[model samples]
Target chain A: MDTRPDSGHVLSADRPGRFGPYGGRYVPEALIAALDELDREYAAAKQDPAFTAELDHLLTTYTGRPTPITEAARFGAEAAGGARVLLKREDLNHTGSHKINNVLGQALLTKRIGKPRVIAETGAGQHGVATATAAALMGLECVIYMGEEDTRRQALNVARMRLLGATVVPVTTGSRTLKDAINEALRDWVTNVATTNYVFGTVAGPHPFPTLVRDLQRIIGVEARQQVLDLTGKLPDAVAACVGGGSNAIGIFHAFIDDPEVALYGFEAGGDGVATGRHAATITAGSPGVLHGARSYLLQDEMGQTIESHSISAGLDYPGVGPEHAWLKDSGRATYEPVDDADAMEAFRLLCRTEGIIPAIESSHALAGARRLGERLGPEATILVNLSGRGDKDVDTAATWFGLMDDSESEGGR
Target chain B: MTTSVAFEKARAEGRAALVGYLPAGYPSVDGSIEAIRAMVEAGVDVVEVGLPYSDPLIDGPVIQTAVDAALRAGTTTKDVLRVVEAVAATGAPAVVMSYWNPLDRYGAAAFARDLAAAGGSGVITPDLTPDADDTWIPAAREHGLDTVFLVAPSSTEERIAMTTAACRGFVYATSVMGVTGTREQVGDAAAGLVARTKATTQLPVAVGLGVSNAAQAAEIAAYADGVVVGSAFVRRLLEAPDPAAGVTAVAELAADLAGGVRTR
Candidate 1:
């Protein structure tokens, strides 16, 4: 509905919620007081320049804001087919991913709200690590919920979070994955609403979260949009990124939502292929349903039970997506497509070999999609790709996938 | 000697009633409909089918599992309505219990209207305040649906009175200090809350949280006019190897639990 600020939908202490059809405080009765407190605090915090300045200072000084917009020269020749391609270097952010943007903002907000405990759920553990990093920086008690399966697969990330002084709780129930971990985290929030703030990692879930995360991440788009405008003399033809829960994609897409001239493309993980019944292309293959706390496209059976989704990249493996993406897909302002594991991996190798930039497996999906789109566009067309996170944490997995590390070397923890 | 309709009629005979708890479809969708149906059939008085979202920081394990399953099953507001409609088709009085996002997403006024048309008798949004009820409650009332609110033991006596007046249904009296489905015994504390609430308003006060088995249900029923057993019924459905059988089995337990609480 009226999502614009002029429409009187702008957030206020009185209306600290209401994000079009996207945001509001959807919580348990027990936490109503806490939510009201947070709402009051966040509204004031939003108005406080000191809060904004402190966050801005940290984002710039600590998380390394204004990350480079590097043009993929050699990789552009191959993937871009001689077209201009630039990458917003969020990988250079502290903790090696764009997840730092939202975490830092939420941590600051948590403090302002006087909540001492921070809880989050992670899949690939990138968000967990970033949250742990923020919690350590803010000196907040952090509890991270991870799927039992993800903890084992992303052991380095697990270790990294522990190193940051965050307690990692392995969720063994349900699918034992990101969705389940989120469920567990919600349980904890419901149990400890007074002292805890749930720091969601994506631009999804019920109202305020999707909007909040996007606002926090909007820096990526704000910076990238400005960088592209300054560098290319105009906005790029398309802004493309991968969509697991649509954080980075929304991060880069939000600033350009009203910019009709700029096309936004979100690439989802297609494990083998969408046709192979092994993929996480929820926006494409899924029908309108609900999952993970919001109404959105879901990969569900006839009875509306969520079906298991698969992807080689652990981060991209989920059955549902953020509701705004569903709106964007329906409205056709943005388009979501899929890139298979083999294609993403191929792009990963090509980017590394040509540009010396090893992209995260999740980001590689966007790179792969950009490569396909760039070929169709003329050389005059410029495309901006949100390089959502770094690949350093993925080296071990990449090494195994590319057969770079020997068995013994691969066995050693990075 | 008594039925859900009779109990519901009896409650309306005096004034509105309130029932609240986290349900299975809230975090998951598979057993959500069954849970709502079972609660309704068992004479829940008014069903709060929690549409599970990601950041439910206030629910206990049973409710958490329900939310998890709702999320995993990809349950959303539309699905919640679909479930509600299915249960409403049974002519059961119900409420679409959820966080504000779904109501906002579906358009609060339209959602309330649709819920009423679908036979939803009321709403129990713990997050929505009386002052802000202008956002959706007007529309909710326009749709022939009541606005149910919550009052906890920790709530001030003034808050109890204000919320009771704001509420169209009974005041949802929390039996314990924590989220839904945490206590083994509701103890004297819940009974004391019920007495305090009764002193303030004539509205029905249904006690939930930790009231699972028949004995516990009967225990709480001794003081309060109505009793809500959520996690126990949800756990029955979830732990059941077969979902349909789980539905039937949970319905039976609800039958037993409701029977224990029913005043003949």
Candidate 2:
């Protein structure tokens, strides 16, 4: 109970349902009961030692938690004149991403809440695959809503979820991406709320979701903080993570919030580039508005309609970030920057060639930002980057982008 | 042309008021205005002009399709206000029913000022609860506009009390615990919900979300002060051969529902 990132509840939101004018229960009346029930269950479960113990058991034994931090020596040599680079290997988790942390916790809560089924929305498919894996483990009927475009881009992940016995519904509305997938999932939740629990993918949406998901995933930082101190006898100079809905970034940044000496950086997906009018750099380019139950910085036009965001990485291709991130951005606790696609891909290749690690495109953005930070802060300052997911799901996209795939190997041309 | 006047007229006629809904820019901005005009002429008492948003979480497939089409066709808040202005000019009360973002982005005070200037009544926010409302209520109070909130079958007595008290025009009691769409039968819990809402407030209570047909309207009318219909009117537009035919179809359905509200 004392392990919360809220610094003994001193830094938590002054009230529930919001983080300084960011999050609220903006959903319809139909979902109020379910959300209230979930809020009560999660609050009680979080305080119960038995619940935390069971979660810790599953995380340690099943998810292979306490995921290690590896110093990317060869990769670090290319930037900051030989600065140390530590990569948090969340890519090595059970479902190949940090998403499993939240999924497993929510799946357990689903059973405790007595819901027979669970539903989720995903982009890039990492969350969907993790949700399916947890549902399979927990014997819950899983349904995942994915953007039609994402389903095409992340075909391998689609296959992974189906193999895990989860139903995948491709959302085709409004830009056909993560935002649309969330809309479809909310619709499904509104319809089947009596028997189904919505296993929200990231640190966003209505109240409790942002806090709940962040609490579940923050163990990454909790473990890594001690590990880094043990290895180097000091905290790293900067902590970096890729932010889509900001689950992973928040996971790594929460532990460092109290450590003022450690700077926190979040790399957003910049497709084409921010100036090119094609990017998912929401916090960097967006104005404050409500979308998907949270009032956060969003890319919108003059008319308040949500503008579609572009990103090479499916997981990072969202128009919104977590409300807590919005609060952090305003409060000056964390700095966010846009990492262009070319830079991310280059970092992805660098990690592959130097460290023999294939980083997910989403995580590559953080790697790219870390390399840039190294260039600025010099070789003496250490940079810790969150390798949020593995590159297996993005192999097809990487191959196409790099022109590595033979025409014969390429099927279903994008 | 205000909501109170519309309700008063309906009470004088010894009938339940008919509140009809259509998202502006559906069909087309001009086409929706024409269709809503037809509905008013055919005896719809209140016109709830929907502000078509990009992400409508509470709307079911039919309205979603219409909203998507409207946004694709470049519907704006300006167009929505224009629709409200046109509908209010018809001597039938008009109000905006939106998902909160468009108005929030446009500035809450400015929106209330403009809506009141357009002779519109207020806002019916399905996603906005009175408890979370700070910007809109103050703005609406300044502009003398109603901020209608909803109560559901699942609403606790405490919540119903809070929601109904915050409500100005009327308390919108959703007949069912789902998004906006048609259902084969009105929810069995509707009467209980209305009665519970009535016990808490002196405000007129209107029932909505699935009362698509005359029979359902008449049934709801027996207990509720007003009957709100949406999807059935939209279904006519979708099922019609052309825009003109759609208007005619919408008029027919509105007339039927209006007759059903007579209850005598």
Candidate 3:
């Protein structure tokens, strides 16, 4: 496992699959060979033009690639000095998020490896929907493990996945949330490794996964960078995106890493606030520890028991961030900020009213962050934000939060 | 006593070792200690005191529930050390089975020192790899503690060699390509992995991950130097109506497994 120094996505030089000391294959022995095989397949795939061409074809024709970049004029005016704000419309992609980018690539890889079934763990169900979509297109059987709590919160996603012919298993073990879902998914993968592949949703997990997912999603930044340059004639002062397991943010940030002048900002979910001890701002309020197969910043007690993360958005309600983000934060390449639920909801509402775009609550964290960042940089600066997902799935939750939907009405809506 | 010493003693008996697992502070801290003592009295050769983690990814529902209960009961690393110390007092070699985070947070050097001082034999880190053992290995060795690493059916020969080279006490051979839980039958992959691992190192190879009843124990012990059971013991405790019943059930199962290994 030598470092691919010339490979655009290989960030760490000496360590092949690490971000500083954060990322490594910390899984059980059973999955090591599978991971190695995946790594080999991925490395070969990167070199094969046919693989890239087919992926590109699918991306453009099936997933609507080069998703548009829009200038948020009305949203920018609300800033302190009216800064120019731009949105990378990943929400416009098929399946309504940047998750499709990674899912499609992994689905293709699964086919290459001759695996017949794919399993994944989902939090908000966006990844599950995207995986199901890709599996359907590839004619592969799909099984998605979601926490019971998340299944209830995002019932529409469950139905959508079922309709797409993917079996959704509601995990009922340990807190019954995203972490639990991941545990179940890993168990499933270990048990069924001979015939199945685990389509990891985010830029977390073991070695090759963090790198692979980032590489697949890197198309977002590669496209956005060229599109931003063509539209603005220059790179923006700062690029911001919300961080949960940090796939979308890492996807967009990787392209801008070489540009020294462009700042990277990662906004994490702050349910109440970091100080209140109820948020998912791992980098802001947590210490480095291991969770879900990677050593990263995790919300854990002194005894290293993971703390339950709270957020209105299920996508960001995870106690750990991707290891790369942890490396970026420590290496002074990126800055992470926390946006509380109230501010994010306000940002969500503002985006809906001003830009006629309903951004997911997960994406709203970045919007909230950009607004504050704009005030600091003032009118002269430009900001690029990744609108990670569409808010159609979040309308019911939003209505309930804004008191527009009564409890009874919400129950009936579900 | 070191884990190696326990294995040597078991080898002298011309039988494989029976290793039992119980999460520290499960049911209660004192109750967990009592259960391990009972297991040892019932002829268990080694005791693995689990340090409950919030995210037990390598565990199935049974061990997850037991570990979750231990966490809910406020099990700390300190409590785990206390349990290990008590288990060790039973003259059964005790090892702490944990994910790497708690030991990392507790300070690897200090954890090794504390465990060594508590008379614990070693550690079984499910998630930590040999490549990532730069910190834990030296610290454990400095404290005269054994370092046990896992080798699976999926491991390459090179990986098996590397893992066995890093292990001091024994190589934990996962009986199946799955998390910790009971299975009706042991996976066919176990024998081959144990043979491969044995070729890499002279260290005794123990098979675990799915061994439950005496039949499975005998099946694994036929090829492995030790038979490690976790979820099955946890299942007994989980299904028990009371704490005393849990201890009785665990001891009875341990005796059965012990007899199976001896017969093998």
Candidate 4:
């Protein structure tokens, strides 16, 4: 049973939700019926023109769809042979990130399923903000579980979610991080399955979720493919996005999978460095294991205990990546590279200084990877980078990292 | 004795079997074995020796805390088998309850062979369902080991049939829709799930998850072939200040549960 679909572009096939033995519903029995219902409703919703039209209308009118692509001439000057860098401006979207794309679609599905309450887990708070925003618009009660440690670091997003009337629960369980938050959220979903929907943030989790989130996010590449052609007169030489749970990268990669010439690259967070054993580069430096519902590349010890992953960017600080990314890696359709925290920060600073665009630290890993890739491909090459989000929510952490704000000021502000 | 034999004997005695759970190496590896042996002596028909895993997703906070302590104390699969071998020597059936990852990592076929050799009766895999047991079920069957799968309150009738068909020694009917924990009241859904599972298979239906006190055990015993309790036992040992006291606490609780299961 090699369950990998023949076409990489297809979301799923008849193989029961597996992406070549990687993705499957590895959840408790309590969630199976809910996941099956979601699978059935999603299959129906895909065929319904009314559902498609409503989603399109919401994406266009509310989310500001077809975000523009900017050519980064100054940023590309440092390339070995003056390559061209094109930026897909997902940062310009509502909620300042590509997370809104998946949230809106799942929120619609949540409403269609008549679930009045939605629960989500957050690491960096971007997904929580987006989920809260959609829940507010739809008048659904939203509960966002965040680790106690993340709440302290990402305090601003907590306030933003609360402002949107989303309850923020600080999880104090195992390791007090993203994984724990997901555990708590799963528990909540199991307990309140009748009234609530779990809005998984990434292209991970059980069956339909990996496929569904990717379909929602494919708009990034769908819009970027045309935008790049309209700007460059042809397709770019490569497409790149950062991979935490790999939602944004898969979103952009799906549309370009059939474009043989356009190479796909995913940048994983290399916290200190893979050599130092303090990184979230799951695909680059991990083995296949199950975590957070899906069997993907995971950072686990020999005893099958999940190891804590470290990254300067909380969004990329996850132990497991999406199963699709693992499939793509094995198929040789996509190249995954590790970008260290220092390198990503350098690229983050360079983008701000040269192009006046502040990228989310999560996205900066891709920028750093793009720079290295561009230098290899030379001047005639065009590379498109998915700039996943703005840096506004991360300013306090960034200021502290760069020593831009005094310790007293940072402490007092929080 | 085999798990089936233990259940048969309990049926002959006109009582629902009392299954007790204790994570190996919680306070220490030897200490846990002693505690479980005491439970068997106190009249537990079946003992489920928990192999501690780092991510026990199906478990509640109490079991999670105990399992965490077990893992921190350096419990491994080898250590787990040692505890099972010792517990099985007590003339009661001893089954290993574990999440699937550790067994997968340890190699499923090898685990089956090792457990059977160690005199362990079977396994209760909380996370591995019927659909996902392609490798494990076949391997367990080859080694003559009992394979227990869980059916939950949320499970549809079709799913209940599918799960019970795949089960061997017994069908574990999760009493609630949530993770493993003790509640003041047994979920009303437990009886319906037990009935549904019973309709599907002749295998004994054991109700677990949230059965804490003797009264709840007695209520479940009226319908189910077995009453399984995990978190309550873990809580008893966890609140104990020392291993000697923990063993006494587990023995006392097991005696009470044993009394509750005697329907005749």
- When summed lDDT is taken over every stretch of 10 residues in candidate 3 chain A, the lowest stretch is A1-10
* lDDT at residue A194 of model 3 (Cα atoms): 90
DockQ of each: 0.23, 0.73, 0.82, 0.70
Candidate 1 per-residue lDDT, tens place, A223-243, comes to 888899898899999989999
Per-candidate TM-scores read 0.76, 0.97, 0.97, 0.97
Worst 10 residues of 3 chain B by lDDT: B125-134
lDDT of 4 by residue, B80-162 (tens): 99999999888888999988878877888999999999999899988888786468999899999999988998899999998
Question: lDDT tens string, model 3, A103-195?
Answer: 999999999999999999999999999999999999999999999999999999999999999999999987788988998999899889999
Clashes of each: 30, 0, 0, 0
Candidate 1 - CAPRI tier?
A: incorrect
Deviation of model 1 at B70, angstroms: 12
Give the Cα lDDT of each candidate.
0.75, 0.90, 0.90, 0.89
* Overall local distance difference test of candidate 3: 0.90
Interface RMSD of 2: 1.3
TM-score of 2: 0.97
In CAPRI terms, model 3 is classed as high
TM-score on 0 to 1 scale for chain A of candidate 3: 0.95
The residue-by-residue lDDT of candidate 2 on A1-414, one tens digit each, is 224537542234565767777877677766777889999999999888888898999998999988999999999997535779999999999989999999989999999999989999999999999999999999999999999999999999999999999999999888899999999999888878889999999998988899889899889898889989998999999999999999999999998888989999999999999999999999999998888887888888888888999999999999999998998898898999999999999888888988999999999999999889988898898998899999998888888887777766653332
